[model samples]
Target: MANLYAGIEGGGTHSILVLLNQSGEIVYKGEGPGLNKWLIGLEECVSRIGKMIRRAIDGIHMKSGIPLKSVGLALAGSEHEKSKRELKELMMDKFDWIESVESCTDAQCALSMISKSGAGMLLISGTGSCCQIINPDGVSRQCGGWGNILGDEGSAYWISFKAIKTILNHEDGLETSLHDISYIKEAIHKYFEVEDNTGFMEIFYAKSDARKVAGFCVEVAKGATKVKDGLCLHLFCEAGRYLAKHITAQLSSIDEKILSAPEGLQIVCVGSVFKSWELLQKGFMQVLQEYKSKKNLKNISLLRLNQSVAVGAAFHGARSVDQILPLEYSKNATVFSQIEL
Candidate 1:
């Protein structure tokens, strides 16, 4: 009898679960919230994740009439060994017939999706940002990922941070382009619903809540787009540069061959930033080109999309199950069908 396997990819903003047959094909997939243990609290995160995973499994069973054999969880908060161990325990306690459970940091899952070789560099920019490199020998070098406070350079939070600063500057007459963004003004009015600048100050500045302040990015972006504000475009460009700086910083420390031309190191970009920002993508590519030209290194080739991160988590789950099931089980597994080359 073939056994079932499960994979969960949890990020700062969302979670993805995949159910795979013994073969590489994905039988079921589900998405949910980010299980950041630090932010959501360990118990709450686990409960939310448990519910999502159960939903996916239940959906798969309804479709296929079978239970999962094993579960693999890859998320942002499992960077430490203790965290990974705790996460595994959490899964084992919540799930049944789960012969085994594996937990790893999000970066490991990203690397797995790159290939079974599981060695390469990955740049992730979403609610947060980070760069990870794995050597042929499995030695890893990581840069950035300092969170939103001191780090998270080029992250969505960072972009929003700067955008808000610009807005503040405009309010003070230090900048000019912001007044044109009525959409932004509207979002602020709705969120803080202030009647004027004085009301806005009373709600935002008086309370000094960072998360509340960060919430304004969406309004700013939406408004800028509606008004055709060039300032938003400039913000994205700057976000790209900020992101590139982190990538280059890591690239500088690694061997040139890893970043070289054909057969060079493959950099896989994973996360929301890659999904949403065309300007960011263009700017990142342009900066890489300039860096390669200046350093006389070969151009880098990026492989795989950000969605692969979840695919990778599922793949890892399959691997964990493979350890117990007959090798034939994996032969029938489903590879990602919708992925474009």
Candidate 2:
């Protein structure tokens, strides 16, 4: 039987599992719910992930007639040391083809894929936002990534909050450009089951966390796009700009030597915020253009990965078994076909 490699990518919304062969061809793929231990109960999350892993292995055996030998997982909630230990334990209890199990936070995998040299910056804005910078000397510094509450400035929730605030201001006669699409208003009202501003306020009054309130952004963005609200458009742009600004601040924190260092610096952007919001993407580029021109630094280049973090996770997993896996494995790997599920 041919040897098989296993890779798993876990995110807030979903999980992807892939099986690849020595030839860098994917033999199987499996998917399941998001595996963030915080979002989903840890026990439930691990159970779901285990099921997906089992399915992936079985699929690979069925398709390629190979026995699985190694598995690597890139987990969404694996940032904390405690969480990583727990995730590793959860995986250890599962299927036996796993000779060695390797795991890493999803962000690291994303950064690795963007910068094969491991020296670059990646801004990931999905349900949350974070900026990662890797210097030529292999020194790394992180900025933002405060999650939905203290940070996540350029996230969908942030934009949605702005849009809602603008709508409310218009209604209160505080602004003139107040635009409304019944679709959005209605959806928000239905989702919250609130009749008017008064009711919405009641819900706001009930829940104090900004993250909880920001949950309304994606649905609203989808609804408002149909109605063509100028205000909604502005909100997207603002969110994007906000994300870019955060990146700028992070970049500024880097040592001047790191900035001007001969080694190449790579910036990677991940997360849903960048992927889902058009405004955020535009704003990020605008901010980058301005920052680069102002700094006169030519060593940094931003990379936008076409593949989702899951692909990176899978690659991370594959590399764990053999850290020396040629860099081309990721580029030529058959993982993409298995990822679609």
Winning model by lDDT: 1
| Superposition error at 279 for model 2 (Å) | 2.3
Off by over 4 Å in 2: 61-67, 94-97, 165-184, 190-227, 253-265, 275-278, 285-294, 298-302, 329-341
Off by over 4 Å in 1: 62-67, 94-96, 173-227, 255-257, 261-263, 281-286, 293-296, 304-308, 321-341
Tell me the whole-model lDDT of each prediction, alpha carbons only. 0.65, 0.62
Where does candidate 2 have its weakest 10-residue lDDT segment?
A: 332-341
For model 2, what is the C-alpha lDDT against the true structure? 0.62
Per-model TM against the reference: 0.78, 0.75
Put down candidate 2 lDDT per residue, 184-225, tens digits, no spaces. 566667766777878767655665434455667766566546
Error of 2 at 277 (Å): 6.3
**Can you write out model 1's per-residue Cα lDDT over 153-189, one digit (the tens) per residue?**
7777777666655666777888776335554555556
lDDT of 1: 0.65
